[model samples]
Target: MGLGSYLIYIALLMIVPLWAQSKVKNTYKKYAKKATSSFMTGAQVARQILDDNGLYHVKIEETRGMLSDHYDPRKKVVRLSRDNYHGHSMAASAIAAHEVGHAIQDEQAYAFLRFRHSLFPIASLGDKMSIFLIIAGFILGASGLIMAGIVFMGFAVLFQLVTLPVEFDASNRAMAQLVSSGVIRNNEERDTKKVLNAAALTYVAAAMVAVAELIRFVLMFVASDD
Candidate 1:
């Protein structure tokens, strides 16, 4: 019964995240093919947004790898993937704008963003250590080790929950900037929103997965106690 329950739980957790990832990729590809009417390349859009926001010191650079765009708050650089940096599609523009949104958050010192940044190192270590601790605890019948594992995993879960708002807020900022800057009209903004929303769902799926994992482990610890 335990084994069967575990299998079911694993299956349930996997489904939503896999589907969400596929949705994000498909939505992005669909919009990537449709060029924006504004004729503004993503790099141009990012630069304009930064300049308008008085973030002239932030740099935009093209990086290799699909869907690898991100804002490096430490370096104050907005990194865009190859296609997003040069392509004029709604997808490209929206993705670039979203990263710039992070830069905006940095400039404003958004609380959640700052918290997420501070948690990065601890979360990274916790993620790697949790599996080993859980496995060891289960094998050795050590409740204390198991509890430690749960606490470590809890940090990761907290990071994920915190990430939800940061991501959603970034997307919101992206949409507003896209509209207000004339980078995209209302109809085009709809397409951009679709892309951003699809991307946001991936983060939601991730948080769900993290929460499920934490719950699963806590249940395991309880069962072991019994």
Candidate 2:
């Protein structure tokens, strides 16, 4: 019965996400070799966008690792991976601009970003220990502990859901800025879209996995009660 009920969730949690991850990687690699017409490096594009938006206080810095780019709201810093920071490829420009979009979101007080930010500590703890708690609870046959695990995992699921819009909006902002600012030409817009869209699918897959996991737990809890 468990296998029958969870078949779809299992498929979604496994196949789709792996595919999305591969697609993003492949897409980024395909465009990473194509330099932008303007020949502006990722760091330059990011700086221009930030300055244009009056985000002079937001600093752009380099970070190690592929696709490690992110905006640290607490530090007011936009950290880009080495390739994105220094490379003048289409992939680099789009990604660097995307991180700046988050900075813009912070400056404008975007509600979803702010809410997700506020949940960081709780969600961090939940992500770390929820699995252990769930396993221990199941082993001990304790419904109370199981429910406690469910609540903890619930925060993680909520965070993933909230993150979807934040990511999409940031990508949208990135594309618009890239085009309007003349960082990317009209012909280059499609490539940027492909990269951003491929990246967005990863977040979608993540949200689906979180929802599926939460549903599986709820269903199991119900079956146990029955």
Task: Identify the candidate with maximal lDDT.
Answer: 2
Q: 9-79, model 2: which lDDT tens digit per residue?
A: 77888998999999999999999999999999999999999998999999999999999999999899999
Model 2 worst lDDT window (10 residues): 1-10
Between which residue pairs do clashes occur in model 1? none
Q: lDDT of candidate 2?
A: 0.93
Off by over 4 Å in 1: 1-8
lDDT of 1 by residue, 1-226 (tens): 3888778678769988899989999999999999987989999999999999999999999999999999998899999999999999999999999999999999999999999988888888889999799999999988888899889889988999999999999999998898889999877877888999999998998988898899888987887778
Which 10-residue window of candidate 1 scores lowest in summed lDDT? Answer: 1-10
Prediction 1 TM-score vs. true:
0.96
Local distance difference test, each candidate? 0.92, 0.93
**Cα RMSD (angstroms) for every candidate in the order listed:** 1.4, 1.2
Distance from true location, Cα of 182 in model 2, Å: 0.8
